[model samples]
Target: MSSTTSNIKFNRRDFLRTSSLAGGGLLIGFNLFTACKPNAKPPVDLADLNYKDFNAFIKIAKNGAVTIFSPNPEIGQGVKTSMPMIIAEELDVAWDNVYVQQGDLDTENYTRQVAGGSQSIRFGWDALRQTGATAKQMLLNAAAAKWGVDVNELSVSEGIISNKAGETLGYGDVVEEAALLEVPGEVTLKDPKDYKIIGTDRKNVDIDKITTGKPLFGIDYKTEGMVYASVLRPPAFGQELESYDASDAKAVPGVIDVIEIGDKAKKLLAGEKVNWTAQLSPSAKVVVIAENTWAAMEGKKAVKAQWKFASPPESTEFHDKKLTELLDGKEFTTLRKDGDVQKAFAQADKVIERTYESPFLPHNCMEPMNFFAHVTDEKIHLVGPVQTPEDAANTVAELLGRDVADIHLEMTRMGGGFGRRLYGDFVYEAAEIADTLRKPVKMVSSREDDMTTGVYRPAIKYRIKAAIKNGELTGYYLKEAAINGNMYGLIPNFFPAGAVENYQVDVAKYDSNITTGAWRAPYTNFLAYAEQSFFDELAEEMGADKVQLRLDLLEKVKGTTDERIQYSPERMQGVIKKVVEKSGWGKQPEGTYQGFVAYYCHNTHVAEVADVQLENGVPVVKKVTCVVDCGIVVNPLGALNQIEGGIIDGIGHSMYGNYAFKEGMPEAKNYDRYRLIRMKEAPKVETYFMENELSPTGLGEPTLPPAGGAVANAIKAATGKRVYKQPFIQYDEIWKVAEKPVLG
Candidate 1:
C-alpha cells in the first residue's frame, strides 16, 4: 500500500534550520540541493566523507553502502539496529550493505528522542519509513531520467534499479543525480507483504563491539587529561550537609581537589519549571577530584563530612502504615468512574477484597551512573549513557547557565537503564563539577552510590475489590496508594474499565522525602499481579475457569464505554487463547501447577502462563509461555530476545527483588545486600507472537506486566496460599521460621 508525506527540502541549511527530518511533523516544501558541489562524487570509504549536520536519516556511498543513523538512545532496547532497519527496508537496500550509526542529540531533527517508555520504535515508525521511501523515490527519479523512462516503469530491489528494457544501475551510480533532484511531494511505501528486511531477523549492529568488550558504554568513555570525580552526598533523604573537611582527601595520592556542590532545590521550587524536576539529589555533596578513578574513590572515602536532619526521615514501616491508613480512609481522588461502584458492591452476593503491596525498586542498571563533561567558556561537551539526552542537555544548559546550543551531548550505549537513566541528575552532576573546576571531569558513581542515591520506583499498595452477584462478575474497584504519584496516567482506561458495569479507579498518594520515579513498566508491573491474582480468586469463587472467565469479561467489554480503551478486547482474547494453547493450560502433567494472566499496557496486549513445581515444598517457576499481540513484529529475533528478557526480568524481580528504606536511607546499598533474580532461578520462557498486519506497538514493557501476575498465581496454585507482597521469597523465609519454631 502507498503512504504519503508532506513535501520537504534536502539542502543542508534547511535540513539543519527547519529540520525537514522531524518525524511525525508536517513538511512544508520539497526542494533539492541547489548548490551541490559541482562535481561531488560519493566517497570510496566512510573515512573520506565530511560530517554533515543534516544527513539525519540515510547516507549512501558509491559502492552501494548505506549508513542509517538511529535517532534514539540505545538502552539495549535494540532500536539502534531495529530503527535503522526500517529505513533500510524502505530505502530498498540490502541488509548486508547497510551500516547503522547512533545519531547525535539533534532535537531539531528528531522528535521524542528519549529512550524511556519503550516508545522509540513506535514513535519513529512512520517517519523512519517515509525517510527511506523518500530517498528511494528520489533515486528512482534519477534512474528514470537517465533511462528516459517513467519512474513507474522501473523497479528496484536491494539498491539496484532495473528498467523495463532490462538495463540496471546501482543506486550509488545515481545518488549524485538524486541528490540534485527535487524530493517527491509524497512517496509510496512498500506493502507489508512485500517487506523483506523488516520482519526478518537481523543481529544487533553493535553485537560484535559489545561482545568483544569495545568502549561502547558510558563507563568506557575517557579522554586525555580528563580528571575523575567521586562524590559523597547526604546519607539520608531529609539530611542536609553541614560541613566537610577535605584535608585528608587532598593529601591522598593523585587527589587534586575537593569541592562542595550546593543544592538546587530552592531555585527549582521558586515556580521555575525546568523539565521533570532535576534536583533528585537536592542536598549538598562533596566531590573528590583526582587524577584517576581509584584515587578519586579513595579520596572520597577519606573525606570527613557531617550531616544534620532537615526534616523527619521516613522508613518502610512508616510507609506501610501510611499506605494502609490511606487505603482504609476515604480521602482519594477519583481517577475514573464508570458506574455506581458503591451500590454494586453493596448489592453483590460476594465481595472479594485483596490488597497487594510492592516495595521500592531500584533500577540497578548494570552500569553505574557516570558521565564525562568538559565545560569551557565557549562550549560544553557532555558524553554519557542517558535515556533522555535532550533533557540532559537542556538541564545542564540551565544548570551551567549556558545556552542549550552550547551544550553538545553524545549518548553512549548503556549497560542497562530500566528507566533509571531517564533522569538527568547524573548528567547535571558531571556538568556541574566540570563547570565548577573549569576543567574536563568525568563523574562516576560507585555501586553503593548508584543504589542508595538513585531515583526509585515508588513503593505502592494496590487494594483491588471485585463484586460478584448471582455467579456473574458485577463490579471492580482499584484503589492505589503510592509514595508520591498515582497510576492514573498509565492504566486508568485499561481492561475491566470497559468490561465491568460498575468500575472505578481511585488514587491517593503520601508525600515523602524519598525520591521515586519510573521503573521499567512502572505501576502496571505490580498492578497486573494484583488485578490478575484477584481475578483468579474471583474465578475460583464463581467456580469458573480462569482463562474462560477473562475471555467472558472481554466479550462483555464491547460497546460498554465511551472512553478510549487502550486495549482491543479481540487482541487481548487472542493472546489469551494462544497462551492457553501453547501452555496446555488446564492439561498440565501432575505436579505442574500453572497460572494465567492477560494484560494490556504500553499500547500492547499480552498473556502469560507460568508453570510452577515444588522443590522441597518450595514453589519454583519452571517455565513460562508468553503470547503477545503488539501488531506486526519488526524483527522476530529482536522481539523474541525482548520477550524472553522481559519474562525473566519480571519473574526474577517478582521472586527476589526487594529494596526498602529505614529512616529515609536505603537499606540495601550494594549487590551484597540487594537481591536480584539469579540466572539459575530464571524460568525457561516459551514465546509466541500473534500474527497480524496491525501497526507495531511497544514490546519492552508490555510483556513485563503480565509476567509477575502469572508467576504469582502459579505460586498460589503450587502452595495453596496467597502472596500479596512483593519479593515472594519473604514468604519462603517466613515459612522456614514457622516450620522450625516447634522442632527446636
Candidate 2:
C-alpha cells in the first residue's frame, strides 16, 4: 500500500464538513480506506499529527470493511480487539469486516497512548464510540440527502443506510460525499441497549498472526541494512563503568564498533534535556553495528569490562533489612488518623497483628524489550515494542536535539507490557545508538539483561493491626515500608489511606541497590495483598463470614467519609456477591481449600476465589473464579482473556516469583533461574462480567491484585499456618515448615 497525504490536504475542510453532516457539531474525519490493504505504509510526515487533540479514527469503506487506527498499543491485553469493538458498536458494523492498524505517533489524535495502568478501555470508551458515531451519522445524512428524506427516518445496519421508504445505500456509495461533509461536533452515541457488538464475545484481532509466528512482535521486526546493537550495564545498581578491553570483541566475527555512551556525558554534552519521568538511568557502554543479534551477544560475552561499585554499597538484603527495621520503629509520617487506636486496642476482646512481606518482581514479559531506530540529520524513524509513542517521541527528540515533529515513533504489538513498557529507557538507548552510528540499529536485550537491568516491581513490607470487641471490629492500623526509588515516586495515597475511618496509615521507604518501576497495578499489587489478608485475619478473630465482614465495613463507611476513597462500595460489593454466588463459597468439596479476595483499581472492581490442594507439599492452584465489574464490556472474550492471564501471572508471582540480589547484583538472570508460569501448571479460570452501562473501565491490571491474596488465602486454608511472605512455602523449604499441621 502506498502512503497518502490526503489527511493534510483535507484537514480543516474535512473536519467542518463531517461536523456539519453530523448535525452541526464538531467532527474529526479519519481515512478508513487505509485499512483495505495489509502492510500499508503511513505517510512519511504524518508523524506531525496531533495525538493529544483528537481521538483515533475508524472509517467504513464502501465494501462494508471497517478500519480502525488504534491509538493505544496492544500488549497482549487485547486492546486491538476491544477498542475496535467500541467503534463497531456505534458504527453498527459486523465484526468480520473490522480491521485494526497501529497508529503513528500523532499527538493530535490520541492521548495516553501508554498502555500501562490498564487505562486503554476506560479512556477509549467514549472517544472511540464518538468517532464511529460521527462517521455513521455522516453516512446516514448523505443517504438522507440522496433519497430526499429526513435523516431521523433512516437507520444504519451492517454498513448500510436504509430509510423507512425502502431506499438504501451502502457505506461505500456515500463515503466520498460523507467525506466532503463537515465533521460533527456532537454525534449522538448509541445507548448500551442498542449496542450489537460491544458486549459480545470476539476473537483477538491478531491471534492468528501470533499463533502462526507472523512478524507482529518487536523481536520479528526486521529491515534490510539494519544491524543489531546491545549494551553492557553494571551488574549492580549505582555501579559505574571503570574501564573495558575491546581487543577480543573486535576480533569477533560480525562485530563492528564498541562505543562508550555514558548517561552523564549525554546529559551534559548532548544538548538533550533529560526528562526524569521517563525513568532512564545512565548507561556507560553500548555495543552497536553488529551483523546479527547472535553475533552481538557473542561479541558482548567476549569483551572484557570492569565496573566501580557505588559508595556505601547497598544491596537488596541491606535494603530489605533496613525497611524491616524502620517498620519496627515508631517514627513514621501518619497518612490517616481517625478514632483513638490506643483506646480501641485496650478495650478490644482480641487484637490481631501480622506483618506481610513481598520481594521485588520483574515484569518478565514473554517478549524482551527491544526498539529499532534509524536516525539521521533530517529525521528519525523509530519502531518496536513500545507502549507509549508520545512519550517516546518527546524523549527521542530531546535526546537527539531534533524537532519533536521530526522524530517519529511507531508502535508494534508487544508480547506483554504489564506496566514495564511505560519506562522508555530502552527507546532512548536505541535512538542514541542509531544517531551515533548513522545507521539503522535494533537494540535487543537478552533475557538476562531484560530481567536484571530493566526496572523492577518494588519490594514492600506491610505491618497491619486490627481490633475486635465482642465480635465487632472497632479499629485498624496499617504501616507500609517499601523501596521508594524510581518512577511513581512515593505515592502515599495508594490504598487503605482514605478508605477507612478510625484507622491509621503510615508509609515509609528505604533506598535499595535495585532499580524499580511500575509493575502491573503499582502500589495496589502489595496493598491488596496486605489489606485483604488483614481482612481475612479480622474475619477469623471476629467469628464473621469473610464476605459479610467486607460488606459490613463497606456499609459502615459509606457517605460518612471523604470523597477520595477511589472506589465505589456498591460496585465492590456487587462483584463480591457475584463471586460468592458463582464460587459456591459456603459449600465445599471434600479436601478442597477455598480462599477469597476483592480489590478495586484502574477504575475497575474485581473479586476472585481460588480453590487449591497440596500436592507433594507444594501449593497447586486447582481453579480460579473471578467476577469483574468494568462497566460495559467492550469485548467479552478479550476481557475474559485479560482476567485469565492476570490470574495466571499473579499466581506465578505469589508462588514462584522472586528477584534476589547477591553482592549488590541480581542473582536470577534468566528464565532458568527466574521461574515463570507454564501451561502444564495453568489452572482452570472461570471469569464473569457484571452487566452495566456506565461506560467501560480497565481490565488488565485490576484483576492482578486479587490473585495474590486469593491464592494466599487458599494456601492458609490448605495448611494451618498462614504464609505472609510471597513465593509462599517453596518446595525446597517446605520441610522446614513440615512440623506445622496440614489443615482441611
Count of clashes, each model: 0, 28
Model 1: CA > 4 A from native: 1-56, 263-271, 731-744
Estimate the TM-score for candidate 2.
0.89
lDDT scores of the candidates, listed in order: 0.80, 0.74
Q: What is the lDDT of residue 33 in candidate 2?
A: 25
Backbone clash pairs in model 2 (N, Cα, C under 3 Å; residues 3+ apart or in different chains), count: 28
Model 1 local distance difference test score: 0.80
- Candidate 2 on 1-744: residue-level lDDT in tens? 111111212244433324232322223444332211233322211122222323566655555566776777878888878887877777777778778887777765455566666766665555566557767877888878888888889988888778897877887777767766655545676767676887788888888988899999888999989999988878777787888898888788998877766554357335546554366665487564579988888888877888887555666678779888879987677766777777888988888999888888898888998999998888899999887678778877777778998987778899888778877888888888888888899999999889888888888888988777778777678788878732322233334444444577777777665678678877777777767877887788788988898887777555645644667788888999999999998588877899999888777889999999878766788999999999877778887888898888888787778777777678778876766777988899999889877767787878888898998888888786677887664444422434232222
lDDT over C-alpha atoms for residue 292 of model 2:
90
| Candidate 1, poorest ten consecutive residues by summed lDDT | 44-53
